[model samples]
Target: MFKGLAVLLVFQLTGEIIAFGSHLPIPGPVLGMILLIVCLRFRTSGRLVEDIERTSSGLLSNLGLFFVPAGVGIMAMVQTVQSEGIKIGFILIASTFLTLIVSVWIFIQTRKVVERHRETQ
Candidate 1:
């Protein structure tokens, strides 16, 4: 578990370095996740994968704990949130819808590709 966590942190740090050096707009963690996915896809280490999966499952089981900071942040910025509540709500709703639409579209496209691959096979 520690090893898997360390590996995750290393990837994130590597991504942060690359993003900072390249001045990319993307978040470091996002880049790190993409890099991790690519590495896992090409790598042939079942034990490493198993460790990562176990670690990921453990982390996910406690995922709700991650929201504590966000909740506290909102509470800290209560005045600002009240002042811009309408605008913030609008942006949040719009972004949520946009995300849902994009996710659905990606799912559809992936399904099509999978179906095509299956047909060819």
Candidate 2:
């Protein structure tokens, strides 16, 4: 688990360095996650993968704790939230719907690919 965490942190730090150096608009953690996905795609080490999975499962189980800071931030900006509540609500709804649509579309496409692969096999 420690090894997995170290790997995750190293990726995040590398991503932060790259993003800072390149002045990219994307968040370091997002880049780090993308990099991790790419590496995991081609990696052949089962032990490392198991470690990552174990660590990830533990983190995910405590995912709600991660939202506490964001909730606190929203409370801190209560006035701003009140003033722009409608716009914020609209954006959130719009984004949620958009995400749902995109996710469904991706799922359909993936299913088609899997079906085609099965037919070939």
Candidate 3:
């Protein structure tokens, strides 16, 4: 498990470095995930894949714990929110809605491209 985790981290770091060096708009971790898929598609390593899956599952299982800090930070900002509550609420709602729209747009675009590729293939 540890070995697989290490390998995943290494590849993630490599992708992140490439993304950084090339000035990619996407985050490094996102690129790393893509790279992981590419690697999986090309390689035939059952044990390694299994290990990676196990490690990923473990990480995901405790994902809520990871958000604790964010929750804490929000709690710590109670006073600020209390002061600018209305404006903050409006801004958060607007930004969240905009993010959702953009994400949906990107998902639709990607789905279209994938469907086209599948049709051609």
User: Which candidate ranks first by TM-score, i.e. highest?
Assistant: 1
lDDT at position 27, candidate 3: 89
Least lDDT summed over 10 consecutive residues: which range in candidate 1?
Answer: 44-53
Q: TM-score each candidate.
A: 0.93, 0.84, 0.71
Choose the strongest candidate by lDDT.
2
The model with the greater lDDT, 1 or 3, is 1
Residue-pair clashes, model 3: 0
**lDDT (Cα, tens digit) per residue for candidate 3, span 1-121:** 8978997898889889989999989888889989999999988677888888899999999999999999899899999989999998999999999999999999999999999999999
lDDT of 1 by residue, 1-121 (tens): 9988988888999899989999999988889999999999998578888888888999999999999999999999999999999999999999999999999999999999999999999
Q: What is the model-wide C-alpha lDDT for candidate 3?
A: 0.92
Better of 1 and 3 by TM-score: 1
Looking at model 2, the pairs that clash are none
